[model samples]
Target: MGESVAGRLFSVLDAFEDGGPAALRLTDIAARTGLPAPTALRLVRELVAWGGLERGADGRYRLGLRLRMLGAAAPCPRGLLDAALPELRALAARTGGHADLAVRTAPSADGILCLVSGDRLPPHATAYGKVLLAVPPAVLPRHTRHTVGSPGVLARQLAGIRTAGLAVCAEEFRLGEVSVAAPVRGPAGTLAALGVTVPTGVPLDRVTAAVRAAAARVRPPEPPPYPSP
Candidate 1:
């Protein structure tokens, strides 16, 4: 390519975009982008000065507010969140539990993507976060002893979600907490997830079925894509 420096700088930014730490040290950025030490240091300094990244007190770098400001102005489907919010709220209200509509992010290695917290938020110890599967579990320091950490365990849970159209966690992710999640579809014909969380001892299957029905009610409007001619 023409300008290796520019490519490297963009790569550094891309590293952050792909779930790099909120703050990355010179070594951290180097490791994330596979850049040599000297190059990482120079690019990070430039990015920090340019307001694309910031060096924090601990000497780690993070995405700066300027990037976030610019990102927010980008266009996205307006109905994306609108279509999910009402049903999320209703689920929360009926279950007396937290509800979420989550989208999987393209960047992270995590099995799931993100959750839109609707009603009450589940305790950090619960699997609502796991069901949503946004950031890789490693990204967030372990918050609870009950958290299901292994990739194998999480894979199994996601399998269950695919088969049953929902996932349930009973005090496995948190103490005295339970969460159930169902998949939701979008206008673009993609599936997101809806979750409800409550204290342990609630009947999780009932909540799961209710959410599954709610997901069925909100059909995605996009026509299926035609195969190649």
Candidate 2:
């Protein structure tokens, strides 16, 4: 049996679930999604026409604003995001603030893999991934020359993240991009992460403060007391 048309189209978008948060070439998409090159190109063209994908000047493709909006509406198994979207939006509206909520984080197959959209960035190289990842890896994947691949160094970073309740990555995954993230936890522990990506020298002190505030606001409201038996 062959894959459904909708599944094929979804596969193209799913291909970007990991790796650096960088625009992907058609070849990269094809290889990642396990689709043929021509097939990937055809699907990408349809997505671009339908506004589900955006192609940049460099001819790389990324999820379009429309697609992202739809993603925001998808069912959240934990219902945590229902309390977060508003705060995330407010944070994003500020100058240079790219706000996000952790979609999910995969098992530690490769020593703590971060999963899609927000999980697209490398855990060792981005603030969002770093905070969500509980254990530091023995060997970190290097996304750039500046990436912190040293396990010892990364352990210290993780320790700081736990202590400060935040993480900050400075051009570790890609030059000119900085990320700050904080964990959103409930009684069960981190339900998700909230973060912002901004450029260098953008007053990180202020951005970090804003992100922390937004994360705080995303806490699920207290449940009403049960009726007296």
Q: Evaluate all candidate structures by whole-model CA lDDT and list the values in order.
A: 0.61, 0.74
Which window of ten consecutive residues has the lowest lDDT sum in model 2? 109-118
lDDT score at residue 89, model 2, on the 0-100 scale? 77
> Model 1, residue 65: what's the lDDT?
58
In model 1, how large is the Cα lDDT of residue 33?
A: 82
lDDT per residue as tens, model 1, 1-229: 3558888998898776564344567887889888889988888888888888877788777777566444433233224445666787888888888776555433352323233532222222344444455323543334466666565666666566556666677776567887776666555444566677688888766787778776666554454467999
What stretches of model 2 exceed 4 Å from their correct place?
Answer: 1-78, 109-119, 221-229
Angstrom error of the Cα, residue 174, model 1: value is: 3.9
lDDT of 2 by residue, 118-199 (tens): 2345567888778877776555768778899788888888889999999999989888888888988888677567888888
Local error of candidate 2 at residue 207 (angstroms) = 0.5
Candidate 2 structure, TM-score to reference: 0.61
